[model samples]
Structures are given as structure tokens and as C-alpha cells.
Target: MEDNSRSKNRREFIQSGMRLSLALALGSVSGLALSKVVKDEYVWQIDPFECTQCGRCATECVMTPSAVKCVHAYDLCGYCDLCGGYFKPDANQLSTAAENQLCPTAAIERRFIEEPYFEYIINEDLCIGCAKCVEGCTAFGNGSLHLQIIHDICLNCNECAIARVCPSNAIKRVKAENSYLIKGDFSKEQES
Candidate 1:
């Protein structure tokens, strides 16, 4: 009878240990799965259409020199002699000279591709997110020049500083694949 009792206790103990081990394994697997699901659901994105050009993206961001910068849509652009993006609206006339240019750093390079056709290029390193150029471009031209967040420079913080202060609610989290160079109009397809 004592032997039978001892064997029964031993079986119970073994079964209890096995149950505990299985529970722990299952808990670990569930935790990993939950984390992956959360990670896959979140991403960062900026909307160009609703942006207010507040200039907060330039200064408020945690990254040094900020991830926000201006991008030019060459296809939508007319490449005219008078580029609204490069010149101040109040300027007496459009000219390549430094004083007339809207960009504080003169970061935009204007090259003549042909008669009445000019190429506008942004020097990303020098841009300060002032939006002066973008504002100029959008006002009088084809709305080609616009602000974009450079992912390499972005901190990709849990909550973006720019999004917090954006009055137009233009910045939001989106999937990583569809992130950059968001052109405002759907009619204009991605040009080669």
C-alpha cells in the first residue's frame, strides 16, 4: 500500500511539472506573436496636400538638421523661365541672382534645359525646411515643389514631434513601403 501511494505521488509531481513547462512555452510564443502584430500595424507617413508649411518640422524634430526637406516634382513642373518655387512672389522679377531667390540658403539650383525650360534641383544638405521655396512654387506654378520627410534622417520616434504640432494634421503613421515623395494629385503618375 505504501509503495502504491509513493508511485501515485511521483506521477502527479511529474504531471504538474510538465503542465507548468507547457504553460510557460505557450505564454512565450503568444507574447512574441502579439509583439510582431503590433509592429506590423504601425508606420510613419506625411501628407503633402494638407501641410501648412508651418516650419515646425525644421526645428521641432529630435533629429539634428531635421528629416523634413523640400522635394521637386520635375514632371509636373513646367521648367519655366520664372519658377515660382525659386523666386519670391514680391520680387521685382525672376532672376538667378541671389537677392531675388526665396530660399535662404539658395539651395535650389536652376539649370536651363532649353529655351523656356528650366530645371529646379534642391540641395538637401542646405535646406532648412523654411518652406519659402515650396510656398512660392505652389502659389504660381504647377505645385511641384513640396515638403517630404527623409527617412534616413528621421528618428522614427514612437510619436513624431512634427505630427503633434501639425495644424492641418498632414503627418501621420503609414506603412513603410508607401512612405516617400507623396505627390498631391493622383492624376499625375510617377514619372520616369
Candidate 2:
């Protein structure tokens, strides 16, 4: 009986130890899975204010045409017929001619809003992320033209090639819900 009691106690102790080990393993696996779910909420982005528009976005992105595209802040735009962002600096006339356009792809489409005012829109498919329009607008216009990451086309690489080579460190991870850093929004923040 004494031997049998000792054997039972040993069996119980082994079972208890196994149970504790299993619980710990399960808890650790759960924690790791939860962390991954939390991480999925964020995506890579470009901070417009920090971006120098060195034209690296056009060349350094892993994607062929690049996931970076030009974004226009119409609210902050002056709607000028002679848009600095839309027309070449040496444009022969402020007309809607392909030759007079600053963008190599002719991505910018101008629609007459009224006399001396035209609404400019960027065709993302045609944009090459060259930043020429952005440079021209910021230098000579209301600074509405800017670059932004198009998440739809982005591969969301673990280590972004463009971010690594970015001269201004403009690229960063941002929450998926509020990914875009609009030019108008940045201007408002600077004022405050």
C-alpha cells in the first residue's frame, strides 16, 4: 500500500507539470498571434513635409512604375488658369496643350472652373512620381501638389527600398485608417 500511494502521488505530480507546460505554450502562441493582428493595422507612408522630392520615389521604389503618386489638395489650390504645377515653366502659352504640360506623362488634367480658374486633377495611372509638378507648385503656386503612397499598388515590403534610400527620411509606417499626409492638412498644422 505504501508503494502504491507513492506511485499515485508521482503520477499526479507528472500530470500537473504537463498541464502547466501545455498552458504556458498555449498562452505564448496566443500572445504572438495577437501581436501579429495588431501589427496589421499599420502601413508604410510618406511624410509630405519631410519629403524633399529628390525624385528618388520614381526610381527607388520596388514596383516598376512605383506606388508613389502625386496628390492635389484642391481646397488649398488657387485654381489658377496658369497653374505652375500643370504648365511648364517655359510653356509657350497657358493653354491645354500636351507640349506645354510639365508632367512627362501628361497626368495633370485641367477643367475650366470659371474665368481665370481651372480645376487640376492628377490621373494616378499616368503619374510617374517624378515630383516635377510638386516642385513647381510648391515653388510658384499654393503648394497643393504633393506625393503620397498609393497603398493599393504598394507591396508593403517588410523593408521598403524607397524608404531606405529616401534622402529626407520622409517614408514611415502609418495607421492604415489615416495613411495619407495631405498638403492642406500639413499647412494647417504648421500654422498652429
Candidate 3:
């Protein structure tokens, strides 16, 4: 009788173990089916028009040195020798002197284009996204200089730190294909 009881107990334990294993496998499968896979379908972008150049981008981004960089729209650019984006308002001369430069990082590189035009290029590595150049450009010249998210440097966080803190609500999630909001493109569209 004792042997019979032990055998029954062993059978019950084996059945319970098998049931638990089956339940676990089914639960795992159900979880996988219910869960949605997230692809890299979207990325963070800044609309140049919406941006107020509040200078928050330089400090609010999660990445040290920030993934934001200045992009100069050559087509929109007047290519002025005395670029408002490059030179301080009180500049003594239209020279490459650090004192006369508006960019604190000296990111805007000036090159002589013609008698009066000078092409300004942004050094992405040196740009701090301070928007001082953007403000200066808009205030005194054609608004060609603007900030853009460098996707290669950007982590593409689900919730971007800069977007949350943006005073102007400029930052937004964009389709990866249409990530960059170029200044000249918008201007051309509006002109047409």
C-alpha cells in the first residue's frame, strides 16, 4: 500500500512538472505574439522656422557636445563678405579674428567667393548648437544658417531630452527619410 502511494505521488509530481513547462512555453509564445517590435522608423528633427534660437539645444541634449550641428544653406545664402552669422555687430573689421567672430566655437569658416560674396561653411565638429550664428544670420542677413540633428551622432532616443526642454516646441519626431528640414527647400516651396 505504501509503495502504491509513493508511485501515485511520483506520477502527480511528473504531471505537475509537465503542465508547468507547457504553461511557461505557451506564455512565452503569447508574449512574443502580443509584443510589437520597434524598428528605427522615426528620428528627431528641428524645424528651422519654429526654432526661436533660445540656446537650449547647446545645453539640453543628452549627448555631451550635443548631436545638433549647424547646416548652412548655400542656395539661400547671400554669401556676403561681412556675414552676420560670422562677424560680431561691433566687429572692428571683416576679418577672421576670434574677437570679431560671433560663434563662440568659431564654427563658421569664411571663404572668399567673389568681390562681395564670401561662402561660410560650418565646422560640425566645433559647433556647440548655441544658435548665436542663427540669430545673427536671421537678424542681419538671409536666414541660411540653421541647426540640424546629426543622425550619425544622435542616439534617436524614444524621448529626446532637447525636445522636452525646447522652449519653442521646435523639435519633433520625423520620418527617417524626411529627417532634415533644410532652409532653402522650405523657402523655395513658399516662393512657388
Candidate 4:
């Protein structure tokens, strides 16, 4: 009888140990799976297509110089001797005169890369996001010189101020890795 009782207790102990081990193993597996699922849900992406070119990106941004700035697309650019974005539409002619330039701050620097090929560079410090240059580019030149949100100046807020006031419903939060410079469908080839 005593031997039987001892054997019964030992068996019970082994069974309990096995159950505990199985539970621990299952718990760990589930925990890992849950973590993976959560990680998969968290991905970053920005939709440059949605940007409305609203001026808020210039002021509401936390940075001194708003992260949003105009970028020149040279590939789609006509490189015209007279850049519409640089020169005022009413200007007498395509001259380097400050009065004739559309840019309020003279941020667009025009250099003669070659005949009929002018390279337009933006001085970011002077850019005000007035969209004057973008408007000119879109109207007469290639749809280059679009506005982009610069990450370095962006606060990366949970809710972007520019996103709220955007008339075209542009401005989307994307992952940090894929944050900016997405020229989707703009067709402007990157300049070398």
C-alpha cells in the first residue's frame, strides 16, 4: 500500500511539471506571434501625391524654416532660356532683373548649363512656400518645382497642422524611413 501511494504521488508530480512546461512554451510562442503582428501593423509611408501645396507647412511647422520647401525637377524641366518659374509672366523679357523674377526672395538661381538649358536651383534659406514658383512651373514649364516636406525641419507631429488646413486633402503621415522625397507620378527625373 505504501509503495502504491508513493508511486501515485510521483506520477502526479510529473504530470503537473509537464503541464507547467507546456503552458510556458505556449505562452512564449503566443507572445512572439503577437509581437510580430504588432510590428507588422506599424509601417511608415508618405504620399507626396496628396500634398496640396498649402502655405501652412511653412508656418505651422515647429521648425524655424518649415520642413516644407519647393523642389526643382530638372529632368521634366524644359531648361528654357526663359524659365516661367523664374520670370514674372508680365515681365518685359526673361532677364535676371529682380523686379522681373516671380520669386519674392530671389531664391531661384538660374545658371546657364548650356544653350536653351538653364539650371534652376533653390536657395532653401530664402524659400517662403508662397507657391509662386510652383504655380509658374506647373503653368508653363514641366510640373517640376513641387513642394515637399523636409523631414529635418518637420516635427513629425502626431497630427500635422498643414494636413488639417489642406484644401486638397494633401499631407499624410508616413514612416520615418520612407518619409520624404517621394515624387510619385510627378514624372520629373532626378537631376545628376
Best by lDDT: 3
lDDT of 4 by residue, 1-192 (tens): 999999999999999999999999999999998786633222222244555455566676656666677877566677888787899999987778898999888999989888778889999889876778877877787767778776656666667766777777677654555455546333343442
- For residue 14, give model 1's deviation from the true position in Å: 22
Please give, for residues 1-192, the per-residue lDDT of candidate 3 as tens digits. 999999999999999999999999999998997686455499999999999999999998899898998899888899988788999999999999999999998888898877887889999999999999999999899899999998999999999999999988999998898788899886676689
Per-residue lDDT for 130-156 in model 2, tens only?
A: 999998898899888999999999998
lDDT of 1 at 54: 76
Tens digit of lDDT per residue, candidate 1, span 1-192?
999999999999999999999999999999998787744444556677777777787887787777888987677888878888888777776778898898999999999888878899999999877788878877888888888888878878999988988888888887776667467443354442
**Model 1 ranges with Cα > 4 A deviation:** 1-42, 184-192
**TM-score of every candidate relative to the true structure:** 0.75, 0.78, 0.79, 0.68
The Cα error of candidate 1 at residue 114, in Å, is: 0.7
Better of 2 and 4 by lDDT: 2
lDDT of 3 at 32: 98
**Which whole-number lDDT from 0 to 100 does residue 163 have in model 3?**
97
Q: Which pairs clash in model 3?
A: none
**lDDT of each prediction vs. the true structure?**
0.81, 0.90, 0.91, 0.72
For model 1, what is the error of residue 78's alpha carbon versus the real structure, in angstroms, after optimal superposition?
1.2
Residue 181 accuracy (lDDT) in model 2:
82
Winner on TM-score (3 vs 4): 3
**What's the CA RMSD for each of the models?**
5.6, 5.1, 4.5, 8.1
- Clashes (candidate 2): 0
Instruction: Give the residue spans of candidate 4 off by over 4 A.
Output: 1-54, 184-192
RMSD of 3: 4.5
